[model samples]
Target: MERISKTITAYDKHCDVYNDKFKEFEPYVQKIKEFIELLEPGMKVLDLGCGPGNVSRQLMLSGKEFSIEGIDLSEEMVKLARKNVPSGKFSCRDLRDISFPAESFDAILLSFCIVHLDGTEMADLLKKVAKYLKQERRLYLSFMEGKKDGFEKTSFSEEELFFYYHSLEKVQDILKDNHLSINKLTKQGYLESDGSITTDVFIFASKGN
Candidate 1:
């Protein structure tokens, strides 16, 4: 996992570029708008792996009363996020090692973030999230579709390390075994760093109320 760690560190160095490149994807904006529509006043929402606070920014600016907290593995990304969203909360930490109090949040959003982790890592993090969430709290996750253990050919700078592309069945197994319920699942186009697009998975699960 050394390569993965190194690539993440390198990404932090170019956080601005990461933000700029992703902003071009209209789908990301559309998803956030949909999320904002689901929220109500005084709800506690967490934006996990929140790169530069883009989604959180949209949520806050939507005139909703939800209390938003953002967390990311990269300190540089957190730094940039804090600059624009000084009034909101931001934490620089790994998703797998997060330290939220039990039943603390009403919702948690993991948008295209867990793709960096492998199967074991994802399962471990999901279990931890289960512990921190309320019985009825929602957990939103996004991942790439198709079967991929590693890539043979790619110019995407972030592709140097191990990454797994998971199927819907695999994600369903993870959620089921962890005692979470899939409230909704959507498959849609995800923009790649190279300006190409590919199908991806989006799931919204909830702890049984």
Candidate 2:
């Protein structure tokens, strides 16, 4: 996980600039509205890898009154998350270190974060998320699709950052292995901070439902 450590450090260094560059954070807003609309208020939702609290802010403004807590590997990013959405709690923590009790959360959101984890890590993390979610809870994942699994250099940042990519089939296998059944799949073009575009795959899953 040395590369993971390096990525975390790189994010900490560029947290502020990254936040500024991340101008359009509404790509998943409509899908998120639809997902949360099926649930009741006061349900706890964990925003996995919630950079700068972008998703958290949008969710709060959706009028759902969801109790959201965001966690990231970068301390500076968590700081910015707290500043960006004061209503949500933000913490700097690795996904692998999660130890929340079973059924502790009603939903989990992973956006632009799964690329940081490889196949094995993704499987393990999904298993944990499945355990934390209630019997019929949901999971939302938004990632950049890839023809193959690999890494690419940064477009805007000069910090030598690299982002991993995953194919839709690979992600589906991982979810199935972890006992999370995909309920919806949406594909669309997503613009990054540097104006480059990539295919975005949004997957909504439930407890093997």
- Give the top-scoring candidate (TM-score): 2
**Model 1: per-residue Cα lDDT over 1-209, one tens digit each:** 67467656666766786677665457777777776676676788888888888877777778876788998877888998898677679988878787778888888888877777777888888887787778777788888877556642233344354456767787788788877899778888755557777788877788874
Shift of residue 106 alpha carbon in model 2, Å = 0.7
User: Residue by residue across 1-209, what tens digits does model 2's lDDT show?
Assistant: 66787787778887877777653445566777777776678889999999888778777877778899999988888998998888898998888788899989888999888788876777788788888888888898888775455434464455655466777888888788778899889998876556777898888899857
Output the TM-score of candidate 2. 0.88
Q: Give the TM-score of candidate 1.
A: 0.87
TM-score for each candidate, following the candidate numbering: 0.87, 0.88
Off by over 4 Å in 1: 151-162, 191-197
| Regions of candidate 2 where Cα sits further than 4 Å from its true position | 147-151, 191-197
Q: Ten consecutive residues with minimal summed lDDT in candidate 2?
A: 147-156
- Local distance difference test, per candidate? 0.76, 0.80
